[model samples]
Structures are given as structure tokens and as C-alpha cells.
Target: MARNSYTIGIVLIGVAIILLLGKLGVIHFIASFFWPLVLLIPGLLFHMLFFNRTLPSGVLVPGGILTTYALMFFYCNLFGWGAMSYLWPGFILGVAIGLYELHLFDRNTHRGVWIAAMILGAISVVFFVITLLFKLGVYVIALVLVLAGAALIFRRPRSW
Candidate 1:
């Protein structure tokens, strides 16, 4: 019961903070620039306070919540409703760190493996796009190299 109440209180506080910012048009102003980076300080503090020495599930839920917030902010920016342009990179970085932490729990886990894999996969996709646009043979080589790197990383032991 106490835990439930605490959880509800935290949720309410978060909502209240957002509402206060919205009501004051602070979010609108902050979104007008790269001020969203200011979120990193509290985010880091929260991680240090609650996530240190925690299990994967503990980190995952909060990480997901933060990622969702980031996405919504990004969407608002993309739609011209906000001003921040570098939101997605922060979101990606947060998710990458969370995934890496989660991977720390299990020796056989491949969760963090997707972080690198996704980057390489994106490179391949970009190369494919370039190949379509310019008929570039070099992009094919780039794609192959990216895939090889991903494959090697995936196949390597997670013991390190």
C-alpha cells in the first residue's frame, strides 16, 4: 500500500511538473532551442539515485518512460510545434546505455548487440539508398563491410 502510494505520488509529481512547464510556456520556449539538454542533469541524477546497482527491470521501466518522453518531444519538434532538433540523438543514446546496462546481467544476452547492429544496419540501408540514387558500386562495398562488422560482433563471445 505504501509503495503504491509512493508510485502514485511520483507519477503525480511528474505530471504536475509537465503541466506547470506547459502552463508557463516554458516547454515551448525550451523546445525553441537545444535547451532540452538540460534534462540530462536530472536524468543523470535520477539514474544515480535509483538505478545504481539495480536489476535490468528496474532500469528498463524508467528508461522506457524517458524514451517515450523524448519521442513525444521529438514528434512535437518535427511537426513544427517545438524547437529542439537534436532530441532523437539523446533518445538513442539513452536507449543504447539502458540496453548496455541490461546486457550486463546475462552473459548470453544479445540485447546490447542490437545497438551496434542497428548502426551498421542503418549504414547498409543508407548505402542501398545511395546505390539507388547514383548506381554507386562503392556503397555496396560499404554495406558489405558494415554487415561483416555486425556479424563479427554478433558472433563474438559476450564474456568481455
Candidate 2:
């Protein structure tokens, strides 16, 4: 229980830090390639060191992959990398992760991870669909998805 709380706190702190960096416009100047690599390294290390005991290795691998893609997308957007093409890569990675979680990972925790990934993957799909259907409004869909994700994370049961 304590470890779960610590993990949740760390995740929230990480999110807060990213938001703060964005608000300060520090993320805008960072190179598009750098943020994903930077986030991937520490994210993998932290998963290995702190979360390994709680999360399965298979789940961790895909989770880290998704995180890397997400960081890449964020960095691309912040640095104005033109039309947000990185989102496609991120969505692909997310769907791959979800499939891996659903098929390859046979663990007690697989259900939760798979469900979460599916929800996120659906949101990503929706964003892309909306962008295709009406190019100017996709950002609003993404924002809504982010808020929903944040709320889900914040309200997640600690006992699990």
C-alpha cells in the first residue's frame, strides 16, 4: 500500500513537473529528439528500480515504450515540429502496447494495464479521427482526453 502511494505520488509529481516546464516555456526550446531520449532513460531506470516489484516486466516494457512515444509527441508539439506528425507514431506505439498487454502479458495486473491502454488508445484514435474529419478541432479532443486521463489517474484506487 505504501509503495503504491509512493508510485502514484511520483507519477503525479512527474506530471506536475512537465506541466510546470511547459508553462515556463522551457520545453519549447528543447530539441525534438532530446526529450524522448531523456524521458526514456530515466523512465526505464525508475521502472527497473522502483516499479519492477509491482509491475510485470512485459507490462513495463510496453509502458516504457508508450512513455517514450508520448514524450516524443509532446516535445514535437512544444517545438512546433509541423502539423504534429509525432502523434501518429505515438498512437501506433500506444496501440502496439495495448495489444501486447492484451495478448503477451499473462499476469494478474495485465487486465488493469490493458484496460488503461485501451482507453488511451481509443482517445488517440478519436483525436486522429477528429483531426481527419475537421482538422482545426483535434486539439480540443486531445485536451479533453488528457483531462480525463488525469482524472482517472487521480481517482485510481490506492488499494490495488
Candidate 3:
């Protein structure tokens, strides 16, 4: 009877706390901002399981993908969704990351997987560079022009 009462008390207390936090909007706030933990938690769990020898290397594929996507989502949530325009390459990078992890961990993985990973990684990098260049090209051109003009003006004549 005592054990039963103790368990009931604990359950009631937990319920009360949960209700209070929900009423205070804490639950809403956490759910809104930290939803990526849903993805990250499972991704990390998959990794932990594989590392602990509870699962196989194949789990790492989804683990890597989910972890990368969760991180990308968190970044967007913290900064702004507008940044997604520049970060679109991260989607391809996530797939590449997963493939690379599979290739690294799975001894039986085919060479095609590695080649695909490399191709995807290269594509992601190229897209990232192109986006960055498009965004910062004007500033780069301006800086180069200023530097060239300054160098021309400051050059010293050779002594004859």
C-alpha cells in the first residue's frame, strides 16, 4: 500500500508540473524552437547504437542524414529561413554525408557508393561556391578594384 501510494504521489506531482509548464507556455516555446531535437535525438541514438554494437553500419546512413538535416534546420531556425537560399546545397551535402559514412563503415560497400558520395559532395561544394560568389561578387570586385588602384598609385619607380 505504501509503495502504491508513493508511486501515485510521484505520478501526480509529475502531472502537476507538466500542467503548470504547459499553462505557462514553456511547452509551446520548446516545441516551437527545439523540434529539431526530435530528429537529432533519434539520429544520435542510431549512432550510439551502432557504436555500442547494438546495430549495424547501415544505420549510420540515416543517422548521418538526419543529423545533418537537423543541424541545418536548427541553423535556419536560429538565424532565419531566408538563409535557406544559400544553404540549399546542404540537402545534397546531407545525402553525400550519409553515403560517405556508409562507405566508411561498411566493409562491403561498393565502389559506386564512394564514387556517388564524392560526386554529390563535389556538386554540393560547387553549388555552395556559386551561390556565395553570386551573393558576394560585387563586394569582391569592388575590393579588387580598390586594391589594384591603390597598388598602382603606391608603386615605386625603379632607380636607373
lDDT of the candidates, in the order given: 0.58, 0.64, 0.93
Total clashes for model 1? 1
Compared with the true structure, what per-residue lDDT tens digits does model 3 show for residues 1-160? 9999999999999999999999999999999899999999988999899989999998988899899999999999999999998999999998899899999988799999999999999999999999988988899889999999989777957564
- Candidate 1 lDDT over 38-117, as tens digits, reads 44444545556555654433454355446445555656655765323323334444555555544554346665455663
Score residue 121 of candidate 1 by CA lDDT. Answer: 43
lDDT value for model 1 = 0.58
Q: Which stretches of candidate 2 lie over 4 Å from their true place?
A: 1-33, 44-66, 74-79, 85-103, 110-112, 136-160
RMSD value for candidate 3: 2.6
lDDT of 3: 0.93
Scored against the true structure, residue 15 in model 2 reaches a CA lDDT of 100
Q: Return the TM-score for candidate 2, rounded to 2 decimals.
A: 0.38
Candidate 2 residue 138 Cα shift, in angstroms, is 15
Q: In candidate 2, what are the lDDT values of residues 7-93, reduced to their tens digit?
A: 999999999999999888788767544556655665566456435466555545555565656576566756777656525646555
Candidate 1, position 94, lDDT: 51
TM-scores, in order shown?
0.29, 0.38, 0.83
lDDT of 1 at 2: 100
Question: Where is model 2 poorest over a 10-residue stretch in terms of lDDT?
Answer: 98-107
